[model samples]
Target: MKIKNLIPGLLVLFSPLALAHPGHGGDHGFESGILHPLTGVDHLSVMISVGILAALFGGRSRWQMPLSFIALMIVGGILGVSGLVIPGVELYIALSVVVMGLLLWRSVQISHQWVTVLVMAFAVFHGMAHGAEMPFNSHALAYFSGFVLSTFLLHLSGIAIGSAVLRFSASGRLVKALGAVVAMLGGSFLLS
Candidate 1:
């Protein structure tokens, strides 16, 4: 493969580290939930994969899934801020990357309603992680806006990449490969 074709793969491999936010797990006067996704590798992968799956599926599924995730995430965040305990939040997040990647790889299509339920469930874990990490005294509006916007953009970026891949002849196989990679990474996360 040429350097151009390799760029996306490189980007994917390096994304978690590249997007690492400062003051992560530190006192930033920011809500933990808002910053949670930014600091965690699993969260980053799931968010990006959500966007990619949206683009690959296209139509209403594209917008609907991510929107469901974002909306539900806020509710989760609220729960997190309230100190509500959620078990295995991190593990579920890692699993989300694996699940979404596989779904995209197979080019699987599910009913819109089911998709809504699934995305909402995952978003709660994501939101809770973020909410739990935020500082209680932080500027609430900016903290919330930053995380929500960042998550949306990550999803959008994935959508864009998937769209671009669709234009290629080998895109289907490429997607499956991406799924495998995500699964591997997720498994590693789970074990660690």
Candidate 2:
């Protein structure tokens, strides 16, 4: 695809990375805490893609998968704050992108139970990153809330986008193609 055509999607896809937080210092305020995930491409893409996949394969999987991610991510955050570091976090995150991308590309019908485990694993890596980056004085709860809310919205946006895609011809094929695109992005991220 031409760079121009890719620009809009790429911007939307990577907007989260451009964002940053002032952290919850003495007077940084709530919005600062909330927008943390909006500053990272990896966080943004993974969260949004999770939502998209959930919607594409609607039913219990929708809620189960994302919820699993949120829960595990919180645990990972705690670990990060406690300085209990987990190695290969970046690799896991990159793998998440690749796995999710391939799932979307193939429209894979993963078992609902397995989906939860997969999401949870991915969440740990994601959450740890958040924890590592958090400001020392930031209000922990508020910062977490910010990321959770942002992630939820990204998922919702994915659902909406997936719904739109379903209206087209051979949506399954198109979605799989989209998945391939996502996987390609993940590959690029790994290389970068």
Candidate 3:
């Protein structure tokens, strides 16, 4: 759409990356897990982009998409913790952001079932990444719970923002613009 519409989304997507914290180490707990997604731009962008995608899709997708993501993410996490290697986890994760953003930018209409599956697929990478990073001696259950909770909150935040943009702004250009920004970020990740 219009360049102005993309500006807001770009800002939201990029601002957090600039402020992302370097990965932390040492004692792990619920708190550490919660902070993990917030610390990395990749995690943060993907999580939020999922929420936005859900919101844009509307209907059952609003809840189903996010739920599917969390469920499959847990499974992915299990795979990671079990030492199952999935090649190109980083590449897939980055692709998720790009695809989600493109979908949002284009406002592509896909069925809820397909959307759920799409989200679930991307979530595996996210969950796996988190699982692989678990501290060797940390409480696995607690850490998993922490990241899940944090991820849910981020999705909710994205939904709220997306909903507001769609409802308040005329033409909903803002959301589309944000999607472009998210996609750009993904492209940057792929290149780096």
Candidate 4:
């Protein structure tokens, strides 16, 4: 099959498949970690948008930004596991989604280094949440690995979506419209 023909199927696969959060159990481990991002709309939205943001930036950022997010998220996770609290972590996470959505909406092509910094900042909060929410006595390594892997996949999905959209259309209006929708969804998540 031609690569072009596969794009639509891949997009369908990338689309959010779940709408509901899963129930948590004691000793949340690898399974929990994998589900964490999927269950949290805030995290899922921001992670995917970060990927699109990279596409918007269109360069080394396509990889650098996501890697930066993953690396810093580990740092934040460590902090959370250590019980060092950052005030307003949740607020920052939700706000990251809103901010990312706006960046996409604007189709802002920021310097990769700056965008990496911003993504790192946002990732800390996300990682912190993962650490903070981990069930007591869970396999920390397994959980972290699960979430990290899932996060990487989510980023890839976003990248693919962004690339596909960019290729077929000369106009960026569609991307901008997607950004607007993302922004609105983030905003609603923030309000509640």
Specify the highest-lDDT model's number: 3
* lDDT of predicted model 3: 0.81
lDDT of 3 by residue, 54-143 (tens): 887888888988888999999999998998849999889889889878777866466667766878999999999888888777799988
- Candidate 1 lDDT over 1-192, as tens digits, reads 699999898666656554344466635533443455667667777887787777766799789888989999888878877789488776777777667666666665565566567778989988887777666566656666768987887888888877877788354888788778877777666555
**Residue 159 Cα positional deviation in candidate 3, in Å, after optimal superposition:** 0.9
The TM-score-based order of candidates, best leading, equals 3, 4, 2, 1
For residues 1-192, could you state the per-residue lDDT of candidate 4 as single tens digits?
899999897555334443223454325688888888888778888899888887767788889889999999988888888888598887788688788877787786556677678889999999998888776767999889988998999999889888887897669898888888778766765666
- Please report how far candidate 1 places residue 30 from its true position, in Å: 6.7
Error of 3 at 48 (Å): 0.9
The whole-model C-alpha lDDT of candidate 2 against the native structure comes to 0.73
Worst 10 residues of 1 by lDDT: 26-35
* TM-score between model 2 and native: 0.82
**Model 3: residues with Cα > 4 Å off, grouped in runs:** 1-22
Clashes of each: 7, 5, 2, 0
**Candidate 2 ranges with C-alpha deviation above 4 Å:** 1-29
